[model samples]
Structure formats: structure tokens, C-alpha cells
Target chain A: MATPYHLKIVTPERTVFDGPVTYIIVRSTEGEIGILAHHMQIITPLVPHIITVYPEAGNVEQFTIGGGFLEVGNDTTVVLADSAERASEIDVARAQLARQRALETIAQAKPDIDLIRAKRALQRAENRLKLAGHSAGGMTSA
Target chain B: MAAGGLKEVDRRIKSVKNTQQITRAMKMVAAAKLRKAELRAKKARDYFEQIQAVTRRAVSKGGAQKLVAPRTVQRKGFVIITSARGLAGPYNANVLRQAVAKMQEVGGKNAAAFAIGRKGRDYLAHRNIPILQEFLGVGDDPTLHQAQAIAREILQQYLGGEVDEVWLTYTKFINPLTHEVRTLRVLPVEEPPAEESGAERSYVFEPDPETVFNDLLPRYVEVVIFSALLESKASEHGARMTAMDSASKNADELIRQMILMRNRLRQAAITREIAELVSGAEALE
Candidate 1:
């Protein structure tokens, strides 16, 4: 059995998760990376994506995180995100609305609107929707 | 005459009681908001400290040359934060006074302000200080998006060379009853001293050191602004809560005194009526 390590996911508004986890997977700017107990220390920026965590053998948790950074230290791994929400906590309707709005804004291509911000918004909405959909589908992937 | 006096006292008591109700309600509201604000501030502080540590390590490695390098001060920018409304005791006044003092010391004519709240905007405007931008209606709970927007404005000014330096002024929350106005430099990011280990560890940077540092610098600025906003918010609520509490207490005291006076006046009027009746009865006898 792999040793469990302390994992904490924090956002500007609040700390979303703080507990011990046996394994965690997150997508960094470079690529997808997984951390286990006693992983080497490194810091990398994260892209908007879903983070999967295994607290125990059978229990699984997922969260959608906005772009931020992840730091693996000596004893703890920390995910510092601009925003984070549990998969179950994600509001599908809101995400869908946001995605629609972002698409409209990008399609219009108004000079006044920031295209980059709109694109990022779309990415976040999609990420949330994907996570929410994955969880609602079933425990098949886990 | 006694009856008229009694009526006046009664009216005064009613007014004082009304004022007391308002202050009491305001105090309760502020207290509730303060609880939420304090929790947010605590969480933000943790993130802020972590980011600061990471930035320090990055700076110690001599990355992000443009941002870490300090230039000669020519023109300065001040980001002043204050509450939107008044009646929060000296909450707005304390920060504004300190901000103005700093502006004057830094060369008033050369300083421009990025006002965060209406109070700061109006105060600086009255002083004829050049306001580069004004953000109003932050409301009770400020979101990270608002902080990001403000940071973007400051970054634009700094990067465009419009301002040589930038300073942030806000009230720092110490406790529920204590808060102090603080001013700290934001632009030309201060390089924190390296860790005491004295041994350089070759840590892995995902893409490259330069890229990570560059991204980290701007993010650091955003985090600083966000955390400061949280702290200032907590302080504002704390100040308002304390202010309203005392105001309510004063109103209570005033109401008590007025009620006492009304009772005394009523008694005096009754005594006067009784004396006149006795005198009339004695004259009839």
C-alpha cells in the first residue's frame, strides 16, 4: 500500500481541500503529472483542468481548478489555484451559460472586449462542465 | 409650563430611542460581515504568504530582471483603498490621512492615485490630487476579479513607464478592535532575502526559469492586491462594527438620560397641579 501524503488545495477565496491523499493527478503547463508520497520537490504552473485525487483505496474526489501553481514540498503538496470547486459543487447550468456567453463574445469579436479573457473563460467553463459530466456519468473511470 | 416641558422631554426620548435602534442594527450587521471577512482574510493570508515565499525563491535565483530591478523614482502611483460609505468612525479618515501624507512626502505633484472606493476618490479629488483611475462600488465582499482588474490598471501604468513606482495604501487588520493604516510598495517588486540555508538547490522549473519567473511576477502582483483588498475589507468591517457599537452605546446613554428627565418632568407637572388644587381648596375653606 502506498503511503498517504498531506494534500491541500487553496484558492484566493478559501481553502477548498485539506487532507491526506494516497495519490493525486493534475495537469501542469508541461503536461500531466502525478504525485505520490515522498515525491521530489518541484514547482510548476497549472492550466485550467480537472484534478483527480484518491483519498483512500476506494474513495475518489475530483475538483476543477483555474490556472495557478502546484508546489511539491518535503512533506506536503499544495495546489494554489485562482479558483477551485469540487466536482459535485460545480453548477452545470451556470457553466453552460458562461460557455454560451464566452462563445458569443468570441464570435462577435468586438474590439472593446478582451479576446484572451473570453477564451480563458470558455476554457474554465468547459473544464468545469467536463468534470461535472464525468462525475455524473458514474464511477466507471475510477 | 411644566406640561410643555414634559412634552418636549418625551419627544427627545423618542428621538434618542430611534437613533439607538439604527446604530444597534448597523452594529449587528457589521459584526456578521466581519466574521466572514475575517475568515476570508485568514485564508488569503495563507495563500499570500505561500506566493511570497515562492516569489522570494524565484527572485533569489536572479530571475525576472525587469520586474525585480528597481529604477530611479520619477513619478509615483498610489493605490488608495477606503470604504464607499461614511459613518464608520475614523476608518476612512485614518487611511485617507495617511495616504495623503505619503503622497505629499513623495512629491504631491508627481504622484497620481488609483482610488478603490468612493471615499478615497472623493477625498483625493478634493485635495486636487491627480486620479489616474477610480473604481467604485466594491460593496461588502470584494471578488478576486475586482482585484485582478485593479492590478491590470496598475501594471499597465507601470509597464508603460507612466509611473516609476507604485505604492498601495490600505488599513491592515490586527484584530477586531485594532487596525492600522499601512503603505507598502507594489511595483518594482521588492526582492526578499534568500533563505538561510546558503546552499543553492537546483530545483526543476517545468518550462524554464525565465518563463516561470516572468509569469510568477505578475501573479505575485495580483495576489498582493487581492490579499490587501481582503485585509482592508476585514479592517473596514471591524472599524465599522466598533464605531457602531460605541455609537449605539452613546445613544443608549442619551436615551436613558432623556427618559429620566421625562419622568422627572411628569412628576414636576403632577406636583404643580396638586399644589394649585390645594391652594384653591384652602381659599374656598
Candidate 2:
């Protein structure tokens, strides 16, 4: 295995994940970016997506994160997300319900209703569903 | 007569017991809330540190205009955070008193108060301080949105030159047994020490570092506000838990004293009856 680097994912409420990981794949604003040990220092904004991590000696862990910033420094990569939760923590039933509600609201498309809010809601639900291992169709893959 | 006195004492005891129960329950609730709030505050420390590191790097690399330069201290903005509800011993009082003192130091007329909780607003209102903004009903659990709203208001005032400096007054949670009310200067961002500046590697800026720094400044402010809110909430819960615990103990003491008095009265009445019975028996003989 390659040299492991410290990977820490923090949200406003708490630290969701922190450990040494050999490989990390995160969805940045540009697209999916992968990191390994000794990655050059870089900073970028992140989008709402799932982050997959391969630890040195354990099963791969995944997290669903909202938009925030990512910084990769010497031997350490930090993800400062507005909100983040482990994939296993996501409730599939709740995500499905939320998605259904958002779809219905979007289909109605009344001028009085907020389309942007509906879209954001749908995005969050889809993200949760995707993180929970459910097949959410027509969304960008991390 | 003894029975009547016993009944009254029992009633009083029952009332005291009820009050003790209520206080005990409140203390338990506050203890649970304090645990959760402390956990949250601890967790948020990591995120706050990470942001601070990145922002510090950006601030160091950026030029003068992008930097948050401190201006002359003229008008000041005080963002005072106190408990929405007051049963928390001196939690609200300590914070409000410090806030008022700080505002006075800045000259009352030059201080524009931004009250985050009901207690602070009531205090400022009573003092007739000019309120820049007031937010109420921020319960024990504060959300990030609330922090963002407060940050936006303070940032606007600072950027618009309404206030040259912005200060935050809140309770800093030290431990369950101790919390101290302190004020922090938030606006005109403070620069990190020189020793901490060596950690940054030659980082690549996507849209340039200045723009990123400018964008990050407001978020830093928001995070600071959020941190203060979390600490204050934890302190509030801790203070309430301590206060309720003491109150319950005092009720227990009162109940014990009342019971002791009732037993003495009953003993006296019984002795009097026995004496009368013996005297009547002797008279019949």
C-alpha cells in the first residue's frame, strides 16, 4: 500500500471522519478529484456529493457532504463541509420520501412555488439516496 | 388538633416534594443538553481550526486591500448572546453585565447593540441602548442558519462603515462546574502569529487567492459567531443544571426541617392527651 495520509472531514456540527487513508476521492467544484499521500498543496471548493475513502487497514468508508472547502497540505487533507454524515447514517426511506415530495412539487411547477428550492431539495435527497447505496438515476457520479 | 396539624404539614411537604421533583427533572434535562452541546462544540473545533488555517494562509499571501484592515475605533457594534429563557442562575446576568460594561467603555452612544437572545434584548432595551438588530427565540439548539444571519448583519454594518469595530459577548464554557463570560473582538480580523505562518506550502489558488480570501472572510466571521453560540448554549445548560441541582437540594432541606417540626408537634400533642387520660383515671379511683 502507498504511504497513508491524514484525512479529516469536518462539518459545522462535528467531525464526521478522521483517519489515515491511502486513497480519497472527493467531488470538487470542477469534478471528482482523487488524492494520495504527498499530494501537492491545493485548495478548492467542493460540491454536494459522496466522498469515498480507502483506509490503510479497514473497509472503505463513504460520506455524504454538502458544499464547502477542501484543503490539501503536507501529509494532511482536510474537508470542511457545511454538513456531512456517514453513508451508513443516511435513512433510505426518508430520502425516498423527500425525493418523492420534491418531484411532485417540481412537476406542479406553480409560479408561487420555489423551483430552486425544490431542485435543491431533490438534489439533497438524491445525494442521500446515492450515499445509502440506492440507485438514484440521472445524477452525476462521484 | 394533632391530626389537623399533621395534615397541614403533609400538604406543605407534598408541595415541597413537587417542587423538588420539578427541579430535579429540569436539572436532568439540562445535564443531557449540556452533554450534547459540549460534544457539538468539541466537534466544531476541528472544522473551525481547519477554516482558520486556510484563511490564515490566504490572508498572509494576499495584498493589503484584500486584508481585513482595522480602522480607527469610533462606533462599535456589540453582538451580545445570552439565554433566551432565564432560569440559568447568573448565566444571562453575567453576560449582559459584561456586555453593558463593554458598551459603556466604548461610549454608550457609539455602541450599536445586536442582541441574539431575549434576555440580551430585554437588558439593552431597559438600558435604552440603540439596537441595531434583535433576534429572539434562539433556543438551546442554535442552527448554522441563525449564525449566518447574525454574521451577515454584523458584516454588513462593518463593511458599510456603520461600526469601526465589532465585539462578541458570550459565555465561554470551560467545564460543567465553571463558565466565564467573556468578550471577543471579531471584526477587522486579527492576524495569526508569525510562528504559525511557516506551515503553508506553495498552494495553488483556483480563482486567485485574493478573491478566495475575500469570500472566506465572511465565512470565518460566521464560524466565529457559530462557535460563540455553541459555547454560550453549553454554558447556559451547565449553569441551569447547577442552579436546579441546588434548588432541589434546598427543597429537600426545607422538607426535612418541616417534617422534624411536624413530628415534634405530634409528640407534644400525644403527651398532653396521655397526661389528661391519667388524671381522669386517678379522679375516678
Candidate 3:
């Protein structure tokens, strides 16, 4: 059996998770990468998505991550995430509101506004809503 | 004479009580500020991690920049950080002491000081310490702009060759009860080791490396300063809480002692009155 590896998920806000995790999944700017114990050392930029960690055989820790960076080295996977939130902690309703706001910002197409940032926000909030789930969705009429 | 003695004691008690109230209030304020400061400190982690990743790759991987370059060991510049507004205990004293010690250890052409808080400014100024810049009224919430202003000044001095390095000294909050005073070198760009030996990742600078670094380094410094401000904020609160707790305890002891003295004085006055009355009654008989 491979040796257990250390995994640390850090955000600007706090150290979200730090312990021995069995395996890890990451969404880099390029693509998704699965890292296990003794993975080759690599550094890459992170994209906005869900990152899952298997702490035990069945127990999992999932997070909605924003753009940042990740480093895998010496059986340690340190994810320096721009922002990350656990699935259980997210407020589904508020996330939906944020998603809608981001989408609206993207649609307005203001000449000076940072469209990229808005679009990224929309995606991030949408992902959170997807995980969190809420009553308010696609009902433009309501 | 008895009345006069009683009044004097009462005044002392009241003054101590008033000071105790102020200390108690300050402690509460520091605690509230600490919570917010800790949150802000937590928020800035991701940005620094990004820098760390790049550093790891740049220094570990093959890079043109060497340790000996001006980017690494420019060992002298100002450290700008904040201290708490009001005094509860040794919060400002610790910072001043720690900063002085660090500078002393460096032991060469002394770095100038850029003070942020009222406490640090007053202490440093009174000692005739050379101050590069003084910023006050940072208030509770410090903005990136404030940091930018300070960073700009420090960067100018560094680029102008007035100082070869810049360092920042501040108290970093470890927890609610404890804070560690730390000194971090901010200027002269430092990079980390590469991802793997012989892994050459080419980074194309938009305008130029020099141009980008000039902008990036200052922004980086500002971010660092902003973080330090938050850390100091939290530390200040922690220190105040401890200080206030002790002050309140002292006040309680002082109050207890004063009450004892007052009671004894009243008892002695009563005794004297009774004795005088008895002597007069005997003389009349």
C-alpha cells in the first residue's frame, strides 16, 4: 500500500483543511489531475471548480475552489486556492443570488467592467449553487 | 482630620475606579477588533500561497535570477507596521522593543522607520529614531490604498539606492491568546526553488521583467503591509484583553483595600467620641 500523504488546502481566509488525506483531485488551468502518494512534483495554476479529497476509504472532503495555484511534492499536496468553501457550509440561496448578479454583470457588457472577472464569478457561484442546491433557479419569471 | 482622611481615600478610590472602567472598555474594543483582524488575515492567505508556488518553481526550476542578484540580499530598508491606538499594557512596548532588537542585530547602516500607528510614532519619535514617513488615522479598517501609499515611499527609497533591502516587523496573531512578533524581509525580490531540477518553464513578461517587477514588487509589498496591519490589529486586541483583565483585577484589590481602610477609620472615630463623652460625664459627677 502507498504511504498516506499530507494534504493542505489553504485559502486567503484560512487553512481550510490540513491533515493526512488518502487521495486528491485538482482542476488546474490546464485540466484535472489526480494525485496520490509519491506523485511527481508539479506546480500549476488552479481553475475554478470542485476539488475532492478522499481522507479515508469512503469519507470525502469536497470544496468549491476559485482560481489559484497548487503544488504536489514529497507526498504532500498543498493547494493554495484563491478561495474555497466546503459544500455543507455554503448558503444555497445566497449563492444563487450571487450567481444571478454575476450573470447580469456579464450580460450588461459594460465597456469598462472586467467581464472576465464577472464571468468567473458567475461560474464559481453557479458551481456552489449546484453543490448547495436551492429553490431559486432558472425561474426568470419569478 | 478624620473627615479629611476619609475624603482623600474616597478620591483615590474613585480615580482608580475610573481608570479601571477605561481599561475595561478598551479591552472589549480590542477583542472586537481582533475578531475582524483575524478574519482579514485569514483572507489574505491565498494570494501569498500563489506567490509561494511561483517562488518554489522559480528558485527550484532553472531560472536566470541568481541569489546574488539585487533581487535577493539588498539587506537594508524600512519596516512599516502599525501598533494599537490605546495602551492597555505592553503591546506597543513589545513592538518597539522587538523592532529595535532586530535593527540592532542587523548592525550596519540602520534602516529608517515608517510608522503607522499613533503608539509606534510617539514612542519612536520621542527616542529620536529616524522616521522615513509617519501615517496616522489608519482607523480600524485599513485599505489597500493606505498600504499602497506606504509601499510606494519604501520602494522609492530602495530603487534610489538609499537602502539595499527592506524589512517589515509586526506582531503576527497566532491565536486569540497569543501573538508572535515576526520580522519579514520585504524588498529585493526573493524567489523559491523550482518545481523540479531541470524543469524549465518559460514565463513571458508582457512589457518587460523590469517593468513588471517594478509594479509587482510594490503591490506585493503593499499586500504584505496590509496583512501586517491586520495581524497587528488582532495582536493588539489580544494584548489589550490580557492587560485589561489584569487591570480590572488590580482595581478590585485596590477597592477591597480602600474599603478596609475606610472601615477602620470609622471605627477609630467612633471610639474617640465615646471616650470623650465618658470623660465629660465623670468630670460632671
Candidate 4:
């Protein structure tokens, strides 16, 4: 395998992922970005989305992170999540329920109540549910 | 002064020494808490930078009037300041003094006070500095919940148009060794200089920009308060450690002086007895 780059995923709650990874893909406010050994130094804000990590010598790992930022410089990719949970760690059932409730809330919210925020919440929960291999795909990503 | 008056000084010295020891222990505990506080602060910065970047983009796109600027300054506002406890030094006094000067300045009459930390709260109250709210016993160890509560209070006030501005006064921890008293503008949403969030990266929000920012902005405010709390906490510990170290040193010097005084008194007594003895011998001869 090519020399693995340093990858660190951190949240205020915990350090979710830290290791060397050969390949990784991150979804940000910009879009999905693939990182390898020699990516330029980039610092950008993250949106609610999924992250897929292909370990240097193992199967891929997945995660969903809330709004935060990423500082990628040198051979390092640091993800600072407002909140983050590993696909293996997040309870799929709970995430689905959260997705349902948020969607319902969005449907019933007052006019002044923000539709975008409710949608983002739905997306965040659904992102986790789908990544965790839920069969339903949250009624959006079909 | 009589020789026995020295005993009173000795007793006072012992009491001061005990107090210093307790202060020293408290300083250590604060130092440990400061470490975590710093991490939370640093983590919070990343979140702010991201939100700020996005907000700047949205604002710059010519949607200023459409989006609500809750913090746009109008009349009066609240400034929350946090200070330290267990006074062995100017730790609390320095911050409160700075707070006084600031409240008199930019705040004018409109700038109300939300003084956190006991010492700060008392100082403002005593001066009859119109305090909108006060949070005491926040302690050297501050919590995220504390930050949230503070945010909620500020938000309620801002949305209700009760205040048009907001600020915070506390010491900022530059390092474990450096703490500086500061008053940070918390309301009117002083947007820091923006980084180039990609224009190409930007697309319409799923529903709209205003909708996204409205939710994010409040969270952004929460995060900012959280950061301040963290900064103040670290500063408190740094100040405590410094204060305790100096206090302990002063006590050591005091003890040395006390010992020297006792030694001199004992020597004086010895000389007097010797003089009496010599005189008695002479009389016998």
C-alpha cells in the first residue's frame, strides 16, 4: 500500500477516529472530497454529511458528522465535528426514529420555524441511518 | 514592644500559612480544570470559524435586510463578565476594575450587565451598576451547561428587543502562564473577517439561506458563549496558580523574618542574664 497519511477525527465529546489511512472521502459544505497523501493545505467548514474512511489495510469505516470544520494541512486531515458518531457506534434504529421525528416536525412547524434547519436535521439523522446500512434509506436517498 | 508581642505575630503567621496552603491546593485543582477548558475553547473556535465563514458569505450576497440581524445595536444591551474567587491576590479585582472602566465607556447607559462569577457580581451590585442578571458560584470549573444557560438568557433578551447589544468581560487565557482581562462584544453579532468560502462551493440552501442561518446563528451564539466560558476558566486557573505561587513565596520570607526576630529576642535575654551574673560575682569578691 502507498504510504498512509495521518487522519484524525475529533469531537468535543471524544476523538472518534485517529490513524493512518490510505484513502478517505469527506463530504463538506463544498462537496465530497477525496484525500490522498499530498493534498494541499485546506481549511473549510463542514456541513451535516457522511464520511467514508478506507483504512490503509482493512475494510472501510463510515461516520456522520454535524456542522463543524476541517483543517487539512501537510499530511494531516483533522475533522473537528460539532458532533460525530461512527457508523458502527451509532444505533441505526435510533437514528431512523430521529429522522422520522425531525421530518414530521418539519411538516408541522410554524411558518416562521426554519424549514432549512429542520431539513438539515433530517439529513443529518438520515445520513447516519443510511451509512449504518438501514434498508429504508430514510425516504429520501432512494 | 514587649517580647511576648512576638507570640501574637507568630500565631498570625501560622494562620496565614494555613490559608496559603489551602489556596495553593485550590490553584492546583483549577490548573487541571483549565486544561480541559482550553480544549473546549480551541474546539469551539473551529465551529465559530466555519459558521462565521458561512454567515459572511450569506450576508455578503446582498441579503442583509432579508435576514434578521438580532444583534444590530439600537439602544441598551447586556455585558456578562466572569471573575475568579478566593481572594489572595488581585485576580478578581483586576477583571472587575477593567469591567468598570469598560461599562463606563462603550456601554454607556444602554449596556446592561450580566455579571458571572461571585466577585464580579458583587462589585457591580455594590456600585449599583444596573445589573440585568448575575450568575454566581460558576466556580473555577465551568460547564457547557453554564455556557448554554448564559446563551439562552442573552438570546431571550436580544430577541425581545430588551437590549440591542451584548458583551462579555473576563480574562482570556493566552497560555497557561498568561491571562489577560478583556471585554468581548457578544451581541450585535460582530462578524469577524471572512475567509473565502467558495463561491463555486455555494449553491442555494435546500430550503434557503435565511432559514439555515437563523438556526445556525443562535447555535453560533451558544458556541461563542461556550468559548468565552472556556477562556475565562483557563484564565482563572492561570491566575490562581500565579497568585498561589507568589503567596507561598511571601509566606516563606515572612517565616524567615519571624525566626530572625525570635533569635534576636533570645540573644537579648541571654545577654541580660549574663550581665546580672557578672555583677553578682563582683559583689561577692
Fraction of native contacts under 8 Å reproduced by each candidate: 0.54, 0.72, 0.19, 0.04
Off by over 4 Å in 2: A30-32, A93-124, A139-142, B1-14, B64-67, B106-108, B199-202, B264-285
TM-score of 4: 0.71
Number of the predicted model whose TM-score against the real structure is largest:
1
Show where candidate 3 strays beyond 4 Å.
A1-5, A19-25, A34-38, A52-56, A59-61, A104-113, A134-142, B18-77, B100-116, B121-164, B173-179, B189-231, B278-285
lDDT tens readout by residue for model 3, A1-142 = 4568988887645688888987888877557888889776665666788898988444887898976657676656777665689888887877878888887887788755477778778778876876675543663321
Model 4 Cα lDDT, one tens digit per residue, B47-164: 4554454445545442443224544555555455556465436767777788778877876766577778777777778888887777777765566677778788878887777777
Residues B16-75, model 3: lDDT tens digits: 899889878877877887788778876765556545444435343433432214643334
Interface RMSD of 4: 7.4
**Candidate closest to the true structure, highest DockQ:** 2
TM-score of chain B of 4: 0.85
Error of 2 at A125 (Å): 4.0
Candidates' C-alpha lDDT: 0.84, 0.84, 0.71, 0.69
Please, what are the lDDT tens digits per residue for candidate 2 over residues A36-102? 9988787777777778899988999888877677888898898888878777788899889988888
What is candidate 2's DockQ? Answer: 0.60
How many steric clashes between backbone atoms does each model show? Answer: 0, 0, 19, 2
Candidate 2 vs candidate 4, lDDT winner: 2
Better of 1 and 3 by lDDT: 1
lDDT of 1 by residue, B7-96 (tens): 888888888888889988999999999999998899888788878766766566655577777788789999999989888899999999
Q: Score residue B213 of candidate 4 by CA lDDT.
A: 56
* TM-scores, each model vs. reference: 0.86, 0.83, 0.70, 0.71
